[model samples]
Every structure is written in C-alpha cells, then in structure tokens.
Target: MLGAMSSIKVQCVIKEKNEIGESPVWEEKDSSLVYVDITGQKVSRWSSLTGQLDSIATENLVGSVVPRKGGGYVIAEGTRFSFVDWVKRSFSTVAHLDKEKPNTRFNDGKVDPAGRFFAGTMGLELRPAVVERKQGSLYSLHPDHSVVHHFDQVDISNGLDWSLDHRVFYYIDSLAYKVEAFDYNIQTGGLSNRRVVYKVEEDDGIPDGMCIDAEGKLWVACYNGGRVLRIDPQTGTQLQKVKLPVQKTTSCCFGGKDYSDLYVTSAYKGMDENALPKEPEAGCIFKVTGLGVKGIPPYSYTG
Candidate 1:
C-alpha cells in the first residue's frame, strides 16, 4: 500500500464521448494527441494548436495507435497488426496474431525505445451469455516483420513502458493488479528476470494504461477508480494521485510543447444508467497541467 498525494485539477479537452477510450499517444511531429475508441471503432486526432478534432472510422475494433517513422500509424485491430494511412483513410494488414482464437482482441500497446511495436490481446467474448477466458498474450513485432511471443495467459494485458535507461521494462496485467518489472535488453528485445514491482490494492482500482515521466516515475490510470496515480517504481511506492471527474480512467500519456501536459482517456463502456448521471463526463479526454514535470517523447515505429 502507498500513501496518497494531494489531488490535482484536470480539465476536459475533448467532449466527444467514446465508448471505450484507450491508447492516448502524443504526436510530437504535429503537436497533436492521437487515441483510439475500441468499441466505437475509430481513431481520433485532437490538435492542440488549432483545437481541431478529426476521426477515421475503422471496420474493426481498433486497440492502439502509434506514429510511423515515415508517415501514417501502426494500429492493432482485432488480431491483426496493420498500418493506416489516416490522411487517405486506407489501411493494410501487417500480421494476424492468434488467429485461431477469434474471441481475443488486441488491447493496449506501444512502441519500445528500439522502435519495435509491442501489443497484447485479451479474451473478449462479445456474444451474450459468453464467459470471458484468460487466454491473452503479449507480443513484440520487430521492424523486420518478425513477431516474438513475450508472455502468455495474460488476463488483461494493459499498460507498458521502459525505464529511462532502457534497462528495465514495466508492464501491467489489469486482472493481476500489479506492476511487474523485467530486465530488458534493448538490443535484442529480450525481457527477463520478471518480478512484481508495484501492487494496487483492491480499493485503489485496477491499473490500466501507464507512462513514464522524465523523472522515471510511473504514472498509471486506475480503471473504475477515477484517478491517475504516480508511483516510484524503484521503491514501489505511490508518490501522488490525480483525481478525475469520471470513473473509468482508461489510459494516459504526456504531450504538449514541453511534454508537460498529461493527456488522459476514459471509458463509459460498462457503466450502468444510474452510474452515467453521476459521471456525466465519463468518456471525455482530459488533460492535467502544472505538474511541473515532463515526459519522454514516445518512439515511433520504424517499420
């Protein structure tokens, strides 16, 4: 258990609600924030400079969105990894993962510092009266079009990031309620020596998406907890907490000119009618400023 820090104020930047908002990424090149709405089946861009919001509809449930080195975006749709030319609304499949299990869908993902795209899947039974299974797995897609299985039996593979030095890798399995660390090899894309680095108590909410700050602190979104927490990975202690007006805080990332604005995404996918009125702002994108800290720019996929 970790002590709570003072609450910080957050403001809604985008009011266009999403069914399940996740994967908030800052496109430094265009000074915009890009994210996906899984259930809504859309990828959105919110420009900070012009206050413009644009969206491209997808035929499948889009999991994550990250910038490509040259242009376009690498996205995880269902079990397929694909590249999307947002400007033209065109997409091409890169690879199909876990094709045998149609019940699984790609979830949270990001590119490593070495420019490899890593995404994971979770058992998502969409049919009524179907029970979900723990058949999720994490994988890394190299620039050369190679896929490597990193972990298996993940119930809900979510947040992922590496330390500033790139020697330590941190991951979150929402169902496990713990942040796990691994010894990372930047050159080979190898993760070993896995161990629990931080645990979220049941009351604090389940951990989902995460981002590392310039100071090396891990900021995690607490799903159904209505807050984003900052923790010291080295000591596994909670350093601070930023309360949000909504309950389902899905993911977060740092953006803005100096990378000082923390952009957060939320969800209203599972909220009941009674819960909706209490959290009217549920599904809106949020931003927290004045943290007096910065985050490292996310690496774009070279492939």
Candidate 2:
C-alpha cells in the first residue's frame, strides 16, 4: 500500500530487509545510493537505475556511511571512525572514541559543508527501544585526520545538516524530541548559540535522520510515525508530509538525476514477531517522487 499523500508516490526500491537501516547518502558520481545497516554490520550501495546492490561486511556495528573526498568512504562503526576501501571491501580505522564505555557505539552522522565528518554515538541498547545511558558524544573528524569532541551526554545523536549560508548547524538528539540549531563557524568548525528550532511531539514519534532542502525547509524522518515531515525551522510549522507503509522510517536523502527524489530508509530491528507480519515493508528502502522540490548535494568528508 502507498502512503496517504495522494499526489506523492512512495515505492519500495530495496527489499533487502536491513536489520537497522539508517543513513542514506546520494552518490551523484555513480547515481547510486549508499546507506548502512547497523546491527547487520555492513554498508551497502544500490543503483536505483540498474537495481544492482553491493554490500561490504564490517567486523562491528556500522552506524553511518558517507563518501570520502579522496576515495572510498568513511564509516562510523563501533567506537571508531574508519575508512572503507571500496575496491578492497575493507575498513581501516582513522579515529576511535568511548574507550571506557563498551556499550556505547557510533550512530547517525554526516559530512559538513566544509568536508568535515560529524558523527555521534549512542548509549547501550538493551533492546530495540531501550537505551541505557546518555554517555554518547558528538565529534568531528577533520580533513587532517584529527578528531574534535564537540559535546557530551548525547543520548542518540542522529540527524545533522548545515544551513545554506554555512553559519548554522542543524542537529537532532532523538531522545530530546526536538531539533536544535547552533551558530556555526565554518572556518574553525566551532558551534555556539544553540537554540531549538522545533519540537517533535510524542505522537509523531522520535525524530531520526534529516536533510535540508534548497528552500531551507527541513525534512525529518519520524522513526515510529511512518511519516516524513517537511517543516519550516523558523516558525516550527509543518509545511508538508509524506507518509509511508512502514513505521520505522529511519533516515532520508535527496537523490535522482535532478536531486528531486527523496530516498528513505527503514528498520525492522525491534518489531515483535507478531508485529513484523503486518509491516512487510518495514526494513525496505523507499523512493518518494512528485514532491516538486530539489535538495542540495551532500558534502563529502575531505579526509
């Protein structure tokens, strides 16, 4: 079944059923989509035009995957930031964190406008929805291969994107149920003047991965709400919404020839045995079209 948006068409593009699918990145070079399967411990690249999907398995939980400016890709897995060699299908650690907390692991992340990779971690997940502590922190990996700790005590560092002017950084710590913006200094990679842009009501579900459109509006994925909301950051008003057949809409990115297509990721990790039967497309990747909007290209990690 398609979503409630009558004018918008939502189709399942990938039916691989990732355990915990997150982080969808559009690779314009090859017209492919790159994403991660956290609990599945792998990064996958799928060609929407050809329907060819290739995956590289990692040794630990892989949270996010983004293209590197030099080559291959950068991944946030376990407690470290690693480089994924596309040709060799291997990983090389570049930076590590949370040495003392064995339960914490890297989560959602993305590259900034300046090519710095910003990724964060989450506390121990006792189960699908039960996260234990707030020991996770947000960090940035510079092009020079240096890691900078931005802040601490983040429960689930998820969505991240910078404003068009590169002066504001938008982020989401899922458990907070709100979107926060920081005054960003592009040159120094510094953040200040943090403020709330909008709040995600409990009924709407936890806000997960996010992206910004050319119009400066935000597109946020509602984890258990089965919807993607287009919100105006300044007024906290919902401009539009695209519903999905599945509930766990993890993350979203703009792709396609003109960057007008919205690609969304989902998960089936915590669904009960009985509940899983009803949502057959829970772990699939969806492509939403007819939205009549274009998105900005994502930045790659220069390092």
Candidate 3:
C-alpha cells in the first residue's frame, strides 16, 4: 500500500539550537525524546509531558544515545561504549574501539529488535563536505558486552532501521547517497546479503537518519535537501515528501503519544555568518504532523 500524501504541518518545538542535532529516539518510558549533539558534546532529553529539556555534558563528541533495558542509556561517545545515568547526570565507559584510527568517532546508531546496539564511525570533518574517506566501520554491541565488527571502509555511517518482520536491516552511508539492506538474523543478530534498496538522487541531498513506519515504508531525512522522504522499500520509489524550513535537516524519528508526529533535527554547522541569515531556523528541532501514519516503537538496548 502507498503512504499518505496529505498536507502536513511543521512546527519548531525546540528553539535552542544544537550545533549538530542528531540521533533522536522517543523514550516512551518517561514520555520524552533523547538525542545527541556531536560537535556540541552533549546528550539531551526533552520531556513531552512537562515541557522541560535536560542535557549532560560529555568529554568528547557524543554520537548516539539509546535507552538501556538495564535502567540507563547506552551511548556511543567518541569511540567508547558507555552507560549513562541521566538522573545523576553521569556516564561510565564500558568499552572502547577504533584506537588505531585517531581521527574517527562514532556517528549515528540504533538498537536492533533483539536488543543489540548498532553504531558506526566516521573520519574527522576537516571542513564542510570534506572528510577523511574510508576510515570508518560499523559495529554491533551484543547484550553480553562483546563487540562485533560488521564492515569497514565507510566514509559516513549515518542512518539505520529494520524491516517489519525483523528479517531485513536497512542502513545508510551518507556519503554514498544510498540506502542498503542486509539479510538480518534476529536470533544471532547477524547480517548478510547486502544490496541497495534505495538510491538517493543528488538533488535530494545525502540520506542521513531514518526510521520505518507501521506500513513498512521508510522515512529518510535529507541532509542539505531540506526534506524528509517516504519511500517504498519494495519498489525503491519515493512515495511522499515533506519539506522543511531548514536546509540542513539532519535526522528524524516518529514520536508523540501515538507515534504520528515526525520529529526532525537540523544542523547549522556549515552555515557561515552570511549564509545563516537566509536560514533562520537552521538548527531547531521540528515536529511534523498530520501525515496520517504511525511509527512503531523503537527497541531499547537489552545490554
């Protein structure tokens, strides 16, 4: 079935800008949203019920943050896998990877259905659109505290999601401008049979963060494209497009009580003083509603 094409509304819910706001997850437990700011070095949470926002300062670039079933958050901070105690506002490192490569850091990540934390790394961003290519890899953190290296030679590991039946894994290497799928093993948390599921056009911008909705369609945030695309994974066709006011729409995830609201994150990292004026809402968090679709609940890390 095709996705909705109804007119949607975009509202800026969070006005305080994040240098690079990414990795947004709906924390259903507390009725809040959790996300990270890479260059800003912070993990933040915005309460939907109370209208309060809280942030914890990190020592290095914090890539992603996901709720842990063990009663805290599992985060990829720099190259370390750490546990975050949000209430006390602290985190402790559990493991570290990528020691051989000094410039790489974790980028975007998510939890698989079987509860493994999957995150990938990227080379240092020397400047806008310029990064050390092929210096990164994707890793899986099992519930047992063991890390498995999935693949290497990645320029920018950006987005991730899974199929409805839990048999397919979808991912994005931002620099590749495409989305790939792999045969997923729910029992073993292994992936194989990698192939392209969606090829993004150059005019649509680089595919960043993504999530799957209830209808099995993929919603992809287009960095530098200023839009979110709803795609039919089976046919590799664009079904719907939701435009945003900001040019650097970094990532998006469905939230709200019924998961009908699409929350989008944007970035102003590359915008200079002259360019920033044109896009006044460059770094704000926006909520897109009235799409007439709902998203499934995101999985929390079992580890």
Q: Which lDDT values do the candidates have, in the order given?
A: 0.89, 0.91, 0.90
Q: For candidate 3, lDDT tens digit of each residue in 185-285?
A: 99998889999999999899989999999999999999999999999989999988899999899899999988999999989998989989999898889
Candidate 3 to truth, TM: 0.97
- In candidate 2, stretches whose alpha carbon ends up further than 4 angstroms from where it belongs are 1-5, 98-100
User: Whole-model lDDT for model 1 versus the true structure?
Assistant: 0.89
Which of 1 and 2 is ahead in lDDT? 2
- Candidate 3: stretches off by over 4 Å: 1-6, 98-100
Best of the candidates, lDDT: 2
Please give the clash total of every predicted structure, in order. 0, 0, 0
lDDT of 1 by residue, 97-162 (tens): 744278888889999999999998888845311227578889888898778889788888899999
Q: How many steric overlaps does candidate 1 have?
A: 0
| TM-score for each candidate, following the candidate numbering | 0.95, 0.97, 0.97
Off by over 4 Å in 1: 1-7, 98-100, 125-131
Residue-level lDDT of model 2, residues 147-251, one tens digit each, is: 899998888889999989999999999999999999999998999998999999888889999999999999999999999999999898888878999999999
CA RMSD of each candidate after superposition? 2.7, 2.3, 1.6
